[model samples]
Target: MQTKMGLKKNEIDELIDKAWKGNLERNNVIALYNVNPIILFQLADSMRKKVVGDYVTYVINRNINFTDICIDDCAFCSFRYNEGYILSIEEILAKADEAVERGATEVCIQGGLLEGMGLEDYKLIVTSIKDRFPSLHIHAFSPMEVYHAARTSEMDFRDVLKELKKAGLGSMPGTAAEILVDSVRSKICPHKISSDKWEEIIKEAHRYGIPTTSTIMYGHIESIEDRIDHILRIKRIQKETGGFTEFVLLPFMSKNNALGRIADKRSGIDDMKMHAISRVLLYNVINNIQASWVKLGLDMAQLSLLFGVNDLGGTLMEEKISKSSGSEVGEYLSPEDMEKLILKAGRIPRRRDTLYFMV
Candidate 1:
């Protein structure tokens, strides 16, 4: 059993066994990526079987980006606008109603950090939506958004999270975490929250019992080592808090953005490789490794299942962020479409809510 990369079966098994027990070192984990991609995929798929089985899950969710007006300039973003419309509380609720009409069980809302947006505004968004649809899970705000709210409102980070939880924030979206290395952060999103600060906010959310979805934006300016470093850090936090519900791998969408000038576009193989390697490295610590269909396109997303991915993210009624970055993969996927994609991959498609419970 030799692979194209000249690796042997026993060697592959040795690495896979170490990963299964969570004993693989950083170098050991990095070594997995150097093997023939087919071998890498097989071992990761095997690990995925032991960890999460063959059931593929997706959420019935909608994205409500209330505003595109952002203050900080991230080099890789095309979604921000110098002048953009901020959805009023009524407008935001109306969108949620539309999502409900479309059979969405959850609404994922995150927008640019608008000027004068305080913790109250964040709370109001959650409360207003909750008031209207008490059962709909409001997965709103990233760690940076929460940090911004705390600063604007002049409150402590933990205190802000508590207030938002009380106001009906069901969970947080782990965006704004482009790459958790400060050096990379300085180059891509220098004005954004530091990697350490993002970790702190996520830990605090876990401390307050608010579960969050974790994410990583790769293939832009970071090295392979940087990617492993970011995953290890997330693994450590999950070890401490046990709060992350899932880990989403976002390949940097590099068209029509400032960073596109210098950033290299990731190949489909690289996209699948990232998902596969992440599954092996994080193993049992983060069981749900999701493929971003919007970023990877439906075809590649389906192939990702065999590459150690188990979740298909959400059928966002409308997704603007990726489209803004010149992603022509479109913004919406119907439940039927999602089910078909999952089934075609020879896996069971289960509709999950915000917290991943089967709906």
Candidate 2:
């Protein structure tokens, strides 16, 4: 078979092999962007099979935005509200209780950096939930949040992560990483930490024995080179600490936000190409590539499975950020429904915890 980029089947297979060997070149990966879509998908799908076979994994989890009040005004945010409501300890516990009731093994907790919120506030939430439900995995906090809390409390990042870990923080979420390039950060989130700072925090968390899921929010004011640079940085970190559990792709949900005024919603073709490219690029480095069902919508998310996605992300029972940004796909999907989507895609659905362990 020949692709539009004038690549043959054997050449595509060699690309897949190169990815598996874990020494992929930048120019080769750049060339993949122009290849025929089907050929690109084939290359990614082959890599996916080598990594995790035919089983598609999903975690039964819930997103608990403890607060939406943030000080930083990100261009891509519609979820930030200066006067947003903050969930009290009892209220947060109730959400955790509800998540456990619905068979959730993990509760993804992340919120805005309220001015007064510090290490104590973070530790309180984690400890409260862990005290109530010893088994629930508290996949909480982001790099920026941690950075803010450390600064607010005048504590070291290590101390903050240590306290959270003692309070039962299962893992950190690699968010607030719009793009790892400094120029993009200056435009999209000027107040946010620099790319070097983000990497420093991520590496610190890794040194503290915490694993995190990596992410990329593409399709807005970023070139293809920017996207590749972001993934390569993640690969370099993985090569160092092996702390990333999975890499997730979040196509920019361009609606009801400042970013939307400048950038339109990404095309379906862009979604396929980005996810497939992520798979092939991070093949041996990050074993799992997750597609965000909330951002991609259920239909495109399933189609991503063929484009080299091995994980369907999580069944987030409650989500605010994406929806506030104009996602009308609703907040929740049941475990049964999650399986049905994977099964219809001709892949086995397995329940997983935040750590990607079969639940």
Candidate 3:
């Protein structure tokens, strides 16, 4: 029987072998559309094992979106609030104290780009957190947020990042990057910063010795070619800067969002395929691939271990963004719970920090 994409049996084997041996060429990966789904999955699983091995890492971190009020209003988001729900700096600090009480070593403090707030507001928040909890790593803000801050404050991007670093900002979370192609960005998030701007902010952060993770939110209006290009773009940047610690694959959540209204629905299988394919394609630049349990349900996230994901992502003590978007997964996980989940998946779980240091 002919496969859905008209893939031959032997060609699938050749691609699988190339990926498994870590010698798959970029052109061959782009030719993946002609391969059988089962063969592709098998190849991805093999490559995952060869590269990442059996240990799965989970970080004890808390995600606190200081305010949900956003200006961009991207179609695929559910976390942004209008204005009334914006949390005060004191309220945000209270949440940080709670996170520290719960054994969080890192706090991912981010928010929508408030219209009038300057860079000093961000610096004050970071300074307060640093002054209170000297040990907590403040993995705050994305390039999108940074760009917005720079635009609002009339300051250079590098200087903005440097100030944040001085205020004890630990790292940058590679969010807000839906797809690195302007074509995709134009359709989904036209009001958001351009792809080049996002890249510039991240590259500038790296220049100031701040490490950042890279993410891709796929399975929406983007084509398969665009997805490949996104990965390639990140790989090129990693080669140039060497600042990316891991690559996270975030499947586009489409429940109450506008994109869901216009496009057909996506499934867990699609998410798994992206995770697996990421591992197969980005062999040179990244060593760790994370499965977002908050986006993909826990079961599929657990199953993703076989598909080239080495990290279970963060045990986010409080996650409002994805959950607000119709994600039914729990908001947080204890280190004990992470261990149980990893053991159930037949792998040993190790606790890690933002730097992937075993804790």
Model 3: per-residue Cα lDDT at residue 320: 82
Runs of candidate 3 with Cα error greater than 4 angstroms are: 1-4, 7-10, 17-26
Ranking by TM-score: 1, 2, 3
Tens-place lDDT digits, model 2, residues 1-359 = 78778888787777656767776788778777767788788888988998899999999999999999988899999888934799999999999999999989999999988997899999999999999999999999999999899999999878998888888998999988889999988989999999999999999899888999899999999989889999999999999999999998988887778888898557999999999999989887898899988888999999999999999878899989999887888899888999999999999999888898897
Instruction: Find the candidate with the highest lDDT and give its number.
Output: 1
lDDT of 1 by residue, 252-276 (tens): 8888788989987688888888999
How far residue 280's Cα lies from its native spot in candidate 2, in Å, is: 0.4
lDDT of candidate 2 vs native? 0.89
- For candidate 3, the TM-score is 0.94
Stretches of candidate 2 exceeding 4 Å from the true structure: 1-17
Candidate 1 Cα deviation (angstroms), residue 252: 0.6
Residue 161's lDDT in candidate 1:
96
Clashes of each: 0, 0, 0
What ordering of candidates by lDDT runs from best to worst? 1, 2, 3
Checking candidate 3 for backbone clashes, the offending pairs are: none
lDDT of 2 at 266: 77
